[model samples]
Target: MHDVTSQAGFASPDLSAFCRLDELGLVAVGQRLEPDRAVLACRVVEPDQWCRRCGCEGVPRDTVTRRLAHEPFGWRPTSLEVIVRRYRCSGCGHVWRQGTSLAAEPRAKLSRRGLRWALEAIVVQHLSVARVAEGLGVAWDTANDAVLAEGRRVLIGDRARFDGVAAIGVDEHVWRHTRRGDKYVTVIIDLTAVRAGTGPARLLDMVAGRSKQAFKTWLADRDEAWRDGIEVVAMDGFTGFKTAAAEELPGAVAVMDPFYADVLVMPMSVVFALLRGLSGAVRSA
Candidate 1:
């Protein structure tokens, strides 16, 4: 149990700005901070004007608290406790709760801002799923499921992501270190923007397997016109990837990725240096 100072009067600043409650049609009314979490009490700024069914005035009946995980504030997990007022229509007696869809999806655990932050942390910052879960103050499975679903819905599901592509790079990744399933996954990256000096490279797709058949099959599935548009294929020295590019895209120029090229050169450089030293006689001859 908290007294007045700990419950209602401790927060001296307008927390609405910190969490951007204004964007969600909410205003902070009170705050309570635990040693590890910050809890903000909020109320909806705009209640429904009338009942949707009867178009008559609604009389407030009761209130319910809706809990949502918000973006962390200064490394402390923050949550919003929204005070939602339920109403009953005068004419039809229909009941409804205040609108809060902007804050989150219906029954979603993470706020819209929180969801966006989690997605960016995973895709742009390259943070792992566990880190995202810790930042959101949610379970690991919950964070992973939500982020993957939202990522697919927002990015992978978009039809226009493949447009204007001219260059691609294929590589194998150790997707999982554990021993249960296939550990290697093939990642296809679009280097068109990099080649054209427009922007950084972007991910085009990912498929299972690390063989020539995997790369060739993925290329074959694309529209022939789209495949024809590729002007360059960059990859490591792995003949499997090189063979796939040659067979599927004969017209595209093949080039070694700079990072792999350095790896390949250092060994050759050492071998040649040792040969040159093997016989000061060899050079003199």
Candidate 2:
């Protein structure tokens, strides 16, 4: 068998900079080479194990190897096979396993760094969940669930994300191009950054359906203070949207978006009348 302990010396390759297992109270014991990927075996650095129920020292028995998907190194996928020691409390006679920060929760297959990489791939890199799943070497449903759970915990669940709203925009978007069911959704945006000249607008919420009732219901769900802070609402030429704004945001000014006004406002008769006037002036000149 290949000795992993001998490879930990100075002559061995250093993966500490990228792996950073030390931060999680883990040390890389050895590496197993495979045709497709590399598996790094790790163990907790701390030798002493304590019992959770009673304040007593535990005796180390055997170890259980847990396989976890880790962040990729270069273009190749990497996995961590952690050997966690099982311990028996001398006083309480309780048995427990060693815990490390390598993974987020117990029985989770993805490491902490792997979870971060997956989130960045979806949010910052704009990659699909399937691609992220392939990179993490896991099933599609596993990757999707992990990414969505982490996203909700870190981003969507943030209470401060909705604060300081002064201006907004509402529009409808076609979510799906299918013949079966309703595929339209109402999109709400925070245009406060644009009005303040700070940054581009961001999507605030998306509601199902595209009607005055949908928009009105969304506005009604907001707090009174949030509703009162709206100073302006920009929308297209949809009369239903106008009516909804009038009912919900009576204090705010409703401005027609220039792009939509150009597309929906001018009639063919008005355009021909202006063209005739210009042609007559040119002929007289």
Candidate 3:
């Protein structure tokens, strides 16, 4: 049998690149494929030489194995088993372990790539939570929590997401069916793309309730420049939304959304006639 340490010694550079461990200071020493999953064993490329406190040469004391879920490949869920070596200074008795931040966040179960894949799979590909969980080889709640946390950190928490807003839409949505938590949420959407004929509307934020205070407080968090850029606010029949917009963004034009306005003004006969005309036009096209 070949020594595990020497397995990736002559592995192709392409393979190393595909594994994406060089930047993390890890080299794949072994790989195993199972019927349902794959595992890539990695070791720190550079050994620790000196202690941080005393600047004395250190010796290897022990190693701890860290297993992280990696992005799936070849329809098989993949995992990375990294052997993190701990060093102890004989002079100062100081101890440290190999840094693995490049691979993942501290105490994170999934690698950065794995988290990003799960997020994109759900947001862009519209895959269900159960499907994403199976792809990552994790429990349903695990995948759900990780993906949601990542989304909040990367997308929702970022201040840049609120920029370039010219129009917005607000409505109340049933957030959670369970009685354990808040059942309703105020959903905010960026209608800039929809108004410009560029693409579908993008979700901007979600507040706790449909109350005027909730929406007003959310708007108050933004800077005056961002608030000034808002030209229009479209909402359903809810008067609270209008009140919130009027209070927070007095200059913005508040309009009834097409669906709600049609209901409020146009009779059913006219609505049916319009729908029939649209259908006939579609068939003609």
Q: Pick the candidate with the highest lDDT.
A: 1
| Segments of candidate 2 deviating more than 4 angstroms | 1-13, 22-25, 45-48, 177-182, 258-285
Model 2, position 98: C-alpha lDDT score: 82
Which parts of model 3 have CA positions greater than 4 angstroms off? 1-13, 22-25, 46-50, 54-57, 191-202, 256-285
lDDT of each: 0.76, 0.72, 0.74
What TM-score would every model get versus the actual structure?
A: 0.76, 0.73, 0.74
Error of 1 at 133 (Å): 2.9
RMSD values, in order shown: 13.3, 14.1, 11.1
lDDT of 2 by residue, 1-285 (tens): 887676676355556545877766677888887766778998877765888889799998899998888887764678888888999999999998887654556767788888888877766565666677778878777777776676556644766757999988887765444565667667677778877879766556667788999999999999989999999888887888889989999999999867433322222222222222222121211
- Give candidate 1 misplaced runs (Cα > 4 Å): 1-13, 49-61, 87-94, 123-127, 257-285
Over 1-285, each residue of candidate 1 has an lDDT whose tens digit, in order, gives 646875665765667876799988889999999988899999999988599997999999999999988888776888899999999999999999999998888888888888888877665555666677788888776676676667667755876879999988777765544557666667777778777778766667767778999999999999989989999888887899999999989889989967534433433332223222221122221
lDDT of 2: 0.72
Candidate 3, lDDT over the whole model: 0.74
How many clashes in each structure?
A: 0, 0, 0
Give lDDT tens digits, candidate 3, residues 147-259.
76776677468777687999888777654545566666777777787777786565677677678889999989988999999998888878888998998999999988574
